[model samples]
Target: MCTGKCSRFVGLALLPLAFIAIIVNLLLIFPNGETKWTNNITMQVWLMAGIGGAGLFMLCPSCNAIRAGGKGCCGEGCCGNRCRMLRSLISSIFGGLGSFYCVAVSGTALSNGPLCALTNQTGNAAQWGYHFKAMEDSYLFNKTSWDICVQPPNIVLWHIVLFSMLLGLGAIEFVLCAVQIINGLLGVMCGDCRKKENNNA
Candidate 1:
């Protein structure tokens, strides 16, 4: 049976480990505001799946303790329970974000092929002045089409949004875990003081 102090220490140690996992996941998903050259859709999907699995593994023990009506079973107090819950939630969210990013990037890549073909077929700019005029005319009715024609791939935007959400969630979990660890440590210290007082009495 672990003392409260021991449990608190374990919780404190695990907090950093959990944070590390989150950081690595973020790096894999969004390296330099987009997937790195090493990371493609398949790799990102696998990374996110791993993150979700790790989160669940870290959170399950604490959740079980909480369900058993025990506090600090995972080495912190109720704070440990909260951290575990947050981990699970963020993992699920990241999984969904990862899937969406994969689909969006793949779809955009495929669409660009057709777009390039069309532009090439139109030939020289001087000869395609009429085509450009038609494009401008269509731009009035659908601004999105015009923007898509001019803009490069936009996987970066999706990456930013997803990574921000992951960071925010991870921060919240870290704070809660830290607080719980402190509380558990304090409880152990107080218990020790009471024992000393009783001995003196």
Candidate 2:
């Protein structure tokens, strides 16, 4: 495939995934669509990995890839195809780093479980903490364990779905960026494939 076109396609693919990551991260702040417990949210939720790492970081790099692939004076004359490909390579690296960050944080949050009001024993009062941290098996597989959170109604299920989504999205974004890195390397090595073909003819 043409390196430029491939890079452009990868960039386009990352766009929606990044947007979804941002939305998913934001939703974590308001469990069960309620804001009462927002103050006591988990540290992962406050980290904004989706918005800052996956969303904005992916966005800037994707835009750069699009511009690098587009037909313009940027890749011609003094700039040269090699320089353009190098730029694309750098952008891909940045995108990969961002997606990796999202993946790491999402995985940690999934394993740690949600911060919610647990079933208090001594008195009927709300107590917030990482209730699932001590579990040997992940709460994701145990449907019965979903009842652990008392206040946010189905918060365990909520965290599972959202964090899983973010993890998957970040993974996909990372793969796409990795592909773009290879494409950029090819572009750099071969210069413009079309230009070479034209010269041969």
RMSD of each: 13.6, 2.2
Q: 75-149, model 2: which lDDT tens digit per residue?
A: 453343667677879988999999999899999999999987877886554777888898888787888887868
Best candidate (score: TM-score): 2
Off by over 4 Å in 2: 72-80, 122-125, 196-201
> Which digits, one per residue and each the tens of the lDDT, describe model 1 over residues 51-133?
55334334542332233223433643434344433443343244334334433443332222212102344552222111223
If scored against the real structure, what TM-score would every candidate get?
A: 0.33, 0.90
* Model 2: worst 10 consecutive residues (lDDT sum): 71-80
